[model samples]
Target: METIRYGPEPSQLAELTRPSGRPKGVVVVIHGGFWRSRYDLSLGRPLAASLAAEGWAAWNVEYRRVGNGGGWPGTFDDIAAAIDALADVDDLDTGSVLTLGHSAGGHLAVWAAGRARLAGPPWGRPRVAVTGAVSQAGVLDLAAAHDANLGTGAVQDFMGGSRDDRYRLADPAAMIPLDVPVRCIHGTEDDVVPLSQSTGYVERAVRAGADAELTEVAGDHFVLIDPASAAWARTLQILTALG
Candidate 1:
């Protein structure tokens, strides 16, 4: 219900609420726009409002767009700052964190939780430990995405630079080794990010000893955010199971 701004200027956190008398947990929803400055984070408001009505406090977060170095430290830093801000808000349950992101956001969602696993990343472990993740059409493999040239140069901008960045924070395929609880929902008909992203994720997660499930649904990239679509139903079910 209240929009909160945290971190440095230009860097902000946007949120929506529905006042569910008592919240069961906090769900941080990351908006996907290939991390560009033009897209803004307001689009995810509907998703956050929906989750808030379902007895969950939804924190819709935004960070700086891809920096000259691709949005490295800055993007990552903003994510950590926004999640930590939830602690100051009353009724938030720090122990439970359910992060959901679509497309580019998905990559950040998983990365935020497993940042500590990054061999030599400057930032330390994140405080926003994920209880579960519902990634919809996420870019799980940067190497794959880069090869496919997803989101045009938008993804590349978010990533900052080359393969080194992919290894450090871009590739979820490599980070899956930490084995966090993740649920990937992809539209069987999706063309943007494709079901392959989730499929590859399912394979890697299982191989890495993490708990992961891949569920197929009907529709395309946009349907995942459309409440009327089957993709939304799958998302609800996934979060329900996690909660």
Candidate 2:
């Protein structure tokens, strides 16, 4: 594994590599855990390493989360910086870079992809575009997530505020007009984020005319992160299609 800091605050981004004659691709993974400190990108090591073992370079990213300097524009900013920094790493196929995020990180993945593919005020425009994006059981609708309020005050804390925060920074349902290809995978038994989150996102994305695909399998939220779980295989298929 390798590490890099995208922010001045020592926030880290990590990667796991498998020896391949030529890299198949690079998948940048952002962890979920509702953007809290307790849920570091390190927890997703199994997923990252699994991706590597399955033949892709896995870049696991950790940025400022709640209780640190993260939240709102700062989180988005750091994500962009990390993606940009990832451009310099040696083993990756630059044109084949993909962002795969779980839970809250899924929300981050969509936000980051939108910014990288579209030009607008909220974001300063991406330095470069990525190949694709994957969101696994993400909080796509900020207002909805805040309303449901999963994991105690975890959502609010990670967002650092009211529903408006979700609207501005974390609402991929509203932001899915993005040009980049996006594929979402969610477990049906996801007691945490419900399948509606992914379904609603896909519906809205279709309405927006963006290229999107969503799949539902049998399991819970964390299954996506488990190397031994079925959700990981679905994730692998999605990541490969983008390549």
Candidate 3:
């Protein structure tokens, strides 16, 4: 694994793992912890290594969480910068970049995929485009998640309080029909993040003529990220098929 700095902040960096030879593509592994500082990038290391073993380059990213220097635009800024930073890395085929994120990270993954649809700073003109995405029990609908308070006010905290028009830019559910493909994987018994999050988003996306689908597996929220779990196996299969 190699450490690359996209910005001066300690958290504004990524850990990159490469396959033994040329990689088939790059997968950005985003971790989940309700977008809090306590949950760091270490959560993504296992997935990164696993992707490398499968002959794909994995970019495990870290960004400022709420307790740190992240929230609203700051967190969004870090994600965009981290992905754009890949342009500087050699021997990488950024053209086919994809994202695999769990929980809060899942929201960010889908959100990032629709960056180009947004119109301005913190949201538009992505330097690196997301070709595809996989959301593992993500909090996809910001408005819905806010109302349900799924993360115990996590959505409010991440968005820095109440919803407004600008938030439409942040909600993946609102930004349907993304140019890239999106696959949502949710655990049937996930209570941490309700299965409806993925199901609802996919339903809305399909209605909007977007390339989206959902797959339900047996287990809880964390099972999807466990490298050894059958859920993860299904995830790998989807990733391969998507590519």
lDDT over C-alpha atoms for residue 33 of model 3: 95
* Candidate of highest lDDT: 3
lDDT of 2 at 194: 81
Candidate 2 lDDT, 126-222, residue by residue in tens? 6546778899998787777778887677667766777763475457766768788889899998998888888988888888888998988889898
Error of 3 at 196 (Å): 0.3
Superposed on all Cα atoms, model 3 deviates from the true structure by an RMSD in Å of 0.9
Q: List clashing residue pairs in candidate 3.
A: none
The candidate scoring highest on TM-score is 3
Candidate 3 lDDT score relative to the true structure = 0.92
| Local error of candidate 3 at residue 138 (angstroms) | 0.6
Q: Among all windows of ten consecutive residues in candidate 3, which has the lowest summed lDDT?
A: 120-129
Positional deviation of 26 in candidate 3, in angstroms?
0.4
Clashing pairs in 1: 1-17, 67-71, 69-160, 70-160
TM-score of 3: 0.98
Candidate order (lDDT) = 3, 2, 1
